[model samples]
Target: MKSKFLAMLLAVSAISFSSCTKEDEEPPPPVEEPKVYQLPGLYIGTYTVTQLPNLAPLRYVLAIEPDGTITTEGLGSDGKTYYQQGTWTLTGTTVKATYKTINRTSNEVTQSATLTFNEKEGTLTEGTWKDLVNSDGYIDGKFGKFTRVKDNP
Candidate 1:
């Protein structure tokens, strides 16, 4: 009887100690990263820089391909003809583009813009631009408001 009690106690202790609750044994699913949703349609239109108190504004005819490649032909801040090739991506409602200018008279100019989508007018506006590549001769100021021309075709 004493041996039977000892064996039953050992078995009970083993079963109680070996088993764990599902919550403690299993971990929750890995935390997922935030999802970035791009714009629904093709982004191809005219892009213009609307503010420049010191120099002339830029007007770019932008064409964004399906593979995210971007090409533009427009006027530059230096009052010269400008052509750029770059890439763009959209995160939520904000769109960001990075491109390089082909013409470099004094220094190489790379354009990077973060723009918000205007749903009412079917346009992208209120852009924040940066010249990350050019520094020696490029002017220091905000990129100002960028407006896309209507009837983009």
Candidate 2:
């Protein structure tokens, strides 16, 4: 009976020492890293500018700098040389920019547009724009599109 008691005590002690709760048995799960979203580097493509009635859509190159500035130059379909200067911001997958269209010769802001880009493809996408200046052809519409042509600005 003493041997039996010793064996039972040993078994109970072994079981008690060996058993562990889930938290104590395994190292705390490795800390999970937080999720982060990265902004794109550079985008180069044509953006449409509203032209006078009967004129074709103007062709312009959109240039985004590392400092969130929009600087561009192009020949308007109406036969005017122009450039743009403005700043841009990003929210989620949307990019918003407010720029002024300046006539190269006159050096005046002829029009202004607030463009909102919402394509997440990281390659090509269409965006809508509303000209801040209420001119004849500067109405709100889906007149903006750009393709990611390069990286690192």
Candidate 3:
């Protein structure tokens, strides 16, 4: 009888201990998935003109489209409209583009810019822009920090 009771108690203890398994303990913290960014989006930033040293910076919003088209339009505090239409290429961490800036009077000047895309920080940095054509126009400057505001479209 004692042997039977001892066997039954040991079986019960084994079943109870098995039920308290690592599975019953809190599940290992959910594995986190890596973040993916839709590259084509609105990059909002400012540009400081190299020629006009003391002038206010020009605010720029670059709309990068997936169709290889990019555009930007802005009205400076001096009441001049600045516009850019061009195509962009992304290789590794570098974003390069060449666009034509259309002033209010319809005078278009070609310009090119290069920026470093920082995926970790969600920003565009180490930017530089230059006028491809020396024609009278805007957009000869280094870009300020650019932040991705909208994703896609």
The count of residue-pair clashes in candidate 3 stands at 0
Clashing pairs in 3: none
Best by TM-score: 3
What local lDDT score does residue 130 receive in model 2, on the 0 to 100 scale?
62
**Tens digit per residue, CA lDDT, model 3, 1-153:** 999999999999999999999888887889998666655888899888787799787788889898989998765657776887999999999999988766655455788989998776668889999988755655467889988988876
Candidate 1, 1-153: lDDT as tens digits? 999999999999998877865756868889997543233333433344434554554455666555777776766666777888898887767878889888776668887877786644445666566667876644334333434443322
Decoy 1 TM-score against native = 0.54
- Model 1: lDDT equals 0.63
lDDT against the true structure, each candidate: 0.63, 0.59, 0.82
Count of residue pairs whose backbone atoms collide, per candidate: 0, 0, 0
Instruction: Pick the winner on TM-score between candidates 1 and 2.
Output: 1
**Candidate 3, TM-score vs. the true structure?**
0.87
- Order candidates by lDDT, high to low: 3, 1, 2
User: All candidates' TM-scores?
Assistant: 0.54, 0.52, 0.87
